[model samples]
Target chain A: MTVVMKMKDIFDCKLLMVDDEPELRKMVNEILRREGFVKIISASNCNEARQIFIHEKPDGVILDVSLPDGDGFSLLSEIRTTSAVPVLFLSARDEDENRLLGLGLGADDYITKPFLPRELTLRLRAVLSRAYFPVILKRTEKPIFRLGKTKIDLNSGAVITKNDQLMLTAKEFALLEKLYENRGNIVTGDSLCRAAWSDNLYGYENTLMVHIRRLREKIEPEPSTPRYLLTVRGLGYKLTGVEDR
Target chain B: MKNLMKILTRYVLSAAGVALILLVVNFAALITWTTQSGKTVRKNYDIAQIADSLLRSDGGYTLPETARNKIETNRQWAMLIDNNSGTVIWSLNQPSEVPQSYTVSDVAGFTRWYLNGYPVTVWKHPDGLFVLGNEKDSVWKYCVTEPMAIMDNAGVWIIIILILNSLVAVLLALLFGLRLFRSLKPLAKGIEDMAEKRPVELSTCGLLGDLAAGINDTSAQLKRQEAALSKRDNARTTWIAGISHDIRTPLSIVMGYSNQLEEDAELPQSKREQAGIIRRQSERIKTLVSDLSLASKLEYDMQPIRRSEIALAALLRQTAVDFLNSGLSDSYDLDVIIKEDAQNAMISGDEELLRRAVSNLIANCIQHNPNGCAIKVTLEKTLGNCSLTVSDNGVGFKQEMLDDLNHPKNSARLENHGLGLTIVRQIIKAHGGITKFYNLAEGGCTVVLSLP
Candidate 1:
């Protein structure tokens, strides 16, 4: 059974935002509210953030690096001592050191200031879902991709059709796994070769082509025209399904 | 140290020259004094010739007219003494105070030295001894004798003495030259310190003390100027960082609200389009702020690079794929070509900075060609260097822009071209790489980044 995370469930998650600026807090709260989140709490300083964090037990956090009383890094450390809630740092400090430090301190994501509202919401939702929904992330491990009439099960390394069932070699399975992961996007030939050979694509160009042909024969309904598996000229190969862009 | 050696050599040479001049002058003076004395003796009568001219005639000795004339003209006297009797046998032009006769010892003393206070020269005669004497107190004479061995080796002795004198001159020159070098050594070190921007302090209590003082003053001035320049650079970088930081929150507000307005269903299409423009411009401001801060940081070496080994072909492919997946419009297309041999090419660099460099190249191509363009990114490994080329089939760069990029000091024109290529150059330079910008012949512009 395919288990899907409901948008309502994602909206129901509680979020805590800690920032020194009042307008930024209000704006973030408004943005989250517009994105269908209902329970959004805010703290203007480290002390207030600590108090709210302990009392409300927020499911996710949007933190700023510089707070009035103390910085968010220590606050995150304090939060981590008691909880594993997802924390994303939103700050005006765009330096790489600050970002790395924030992420090193167990932040789920770091978004610099002057970010688009859509980007902010999307990152916040991703962090929330990652922390709360393990099954949705695990679904990728046992994914089933369809190429026309063929059904490829990545977990079992099986390609089943109406006429017969075929098994994929270990190398072919690794190659298809990479292509399926970037299903609608172009995956370069070098990336595919590395996936199959665990090495560079220097001497494996012809071998990659042969493996790709074999893969097409098994999965593509018309291997000659390659309806499912397509090659982007001079770039790479792109795997597409009936539903993919 | 080489300069000190030169000084010593010049000093020794000049010292040797002075010694040579002194020797030449002394030799010339000796020659002149010897010649003058010899001429004076010759002007007097020759004693041996006078003795030979004396002959017994008519029971008396007679002197020749030439000898008589020589003695008269010089106011000198001549005489001849008998060997057995020790008597004055023949005399001419003799002073009245002269003794008429002499014992053998007296004859020996007067003939060898003086007679009656007259300087005399004696020569052996056939009959007895011959004597020629100047007037009383008219000349002074002394006699000297030496062993034959010393006289025979006189040339060797002279040469040894000359060599010793030269050695002493050279030794003294070296001593003085060493003193001067010691005094100037600190000044040389001080100049080196000044060149390296280190503090310079020299002792000012020697022959070169005034020079040391001047160098110290110059170093102080240079240090002050250096400090002032660094202070100004820091202020520039800090001010840019502060302004960029301050602008972020307000820009974020504008961007967030405009983005919301752009997506609001209640807004009219035209209003939404205006909101979109505002949002887009705010985004541009955001990028500009970051770019300004980054450029300032790079200029001041404030940006620390976090280096790691990166696969060149993989990075190029990933960047192209990201641009394509990020909704690069249908108007634009990008192709990544990795040479077969270059597939394994790797370089050590800061991945984020390199990615930014590549992204800026692609963005520059797109920004300049608003209508649309095809960007080709090719990676190749040549002579152990990874070469990445980004080219576009659109309007090539203007000649002015190319000139600005080629000579970055013409930064005034770069303001129009933006900091995109400047940052690329800086990033590549930081990684020990080079960047080239040129217009392709087939109506396109290409930027090639070569990294070792």
Candidate 2:
């Protein structure tokens, strides 16, 4: 419940949406505001987008690839020169080349045109989470973490106490991260499986259990009687007594 | 053609004719000069006086001034044999080995053939036949010696003749080469124009007339092919553009309104579900549009790789993360295995294309194995190549799917199978890579992408 409150606060961020179609901008604007975005600015072309961007200084940007005066990619590049603010591209051209070019140009994400309303909102939230707090940084390698009497170094991918160091595989680390992301909250088993295996989450109940057992042995004071890593039975898994944001 | 060969033979015949004329002229000059020089040598012989002196025969015989002067002027040697006395007489410039005496038979044999291997003229004498021997330098020397000035003049004339002959030969060879090149120049120009993709027309004349005709025909055929191909390509491009510009905008409007209705709290639950269905169907349509457009572009090789240096390990990791965040699946197991060295392995490729190629493979696995599956993505660096292997633990692809993947045309009946595989093959090929599908023995499917 507290996590939901925190997410809603983050959702109330300001954003800039740029598109050539007036209907698209209006629709995206209404959707974003309804999703808790407070101050949303809209632009029909790159030139206007740039002006609004500089003046409003929105927290993030959702830019269309094609514009009247210039391209969204050029606008992103131009904005990147001055700031590292998050920029997501909305393009009708969904070719691999275009997507790669957009992301390679420093845009946070590339979404093809005619995207689902929920999908747009979710991507916006993801970009905002990453830009403000860098959730993705911790996914690969986070800072030092304290767990019970042990110290977990996310950067080194090593967990060490006074006497010994523990090794964690990439999958194990991701599983631990899902729990850490929702610290003191239950992350459903399905969510954990999806985070670990992506789309192949079914029939992985046994695999997830095995990884959880191994993770607990390294962090818990007793492998047989787990302490820090706990199961919520009908729910999923949770990690307690871990210092997480 | 036979006509061309006949015209070419004339060049060889004309050169040969010049050589024959020079040979005849040289032979005529040699005969005339030889006869004239032989008359002078006979007049200078002075045979009467030489015989008188030999007949004096006092063992102190002396040659007359005329005969002595002739010998001195001619640089000749003389010898006399006394056949009646059976003795050899005094000799001038005689070899030391010559005997002083001779028998009748010896005198007869020496005069008839030679005097000590020298050319000798015989005359009737009282005691012995008077014998005048030419010098032994040639064994059959000419009695009339050539003057020093005449020998030098002969050498100069021989060199001038050789120089003239060489100059004429060189001039003829150059003229032949120039004529050949001029006749073939149109053919060379036609070949160059064909290489440059330009319209070519060569005048079919001279030796290469047939070759010129062949080349012009080939050029015309190739131009026609190029025009037809570009026309088809432009039509396809316009169709794809239309799908993007015309269809997606209106689709976006329909999707936006439906989404708004779905989100309306006041709407009844069933009405909201209906709106949700509309949005879902619209999303499906959007996917189909993107797939069809990209597939067509790939089918005709319209897409080109835009290359950049990519750290492959990072890409693999990012791909796995994106799949997880895509929200497309909630019931699949995905795992990534990256070799230690592969973390820094880099290759030049189109990153977006590679990303899409890999994502498509993973998506295909999830789509096919609806119930559940375990997908493993392994990134490893081999000798000079990087391989990305995506394997799944589920019901592998059917025989028909594998066949279509390998040969797209064979499975034209299969709707999405051909399109997806075509895009995969095209993207990988554009990056200078290869893709393969294998049914693992463990009842799973595997796709290996190797890029240099």
Instruction: Give me the candidate number with maximum DockQ.
Output: 1
**Candidate 1 local lDDT, residue B220:** 91
| Candidate 2 wrong stretches, greater than 4 Å | A1-22, A35-89, A95-111, A118-245, B1-206, B254-276, B300-304, B308-346, B376-389, B410-414, B440-444
Per-residue lDDT of candidate 1, residues A39-112 (tens digit): 99998999998889889988889998878788888888999999888899887866734555535788888889
Give the C-alpha miss distance for residue B134 in model 1, angstroms.
3.8
Which pairs clash (backbone N, Cα, C closer than 3 Å) in model 1? Answer: none
Q: Any idea what lDDT model 1 has?
A: 0.84
Candidate 2 lDDT by residue in tens digits, B1-452 = 33444555565556656765676688689999989987887788766667776546355667678777787677666666666676766566666666778877777677677767777777766666666667675445444668889887997887677667756765675578458766766677788889999999988777888999999899999899989988887697658756765578678878988988998999999999999999988887787777777766665666666788886765665576666645546578877777766656788988877888888888888888999798989988887789889999888989977877766673213275435666777788777788889899989999998888
- Against the true structure, what is each candidate's TM-score? 0.87, 0.50
Per-residue C-alpha lDDT of model 2 across residues A15-92, encoded as one tens digit per residue:
888888888888888888778788888888888877887888777888887788988778888998997778877777
**Each model's backbone clash number:** 0, 11
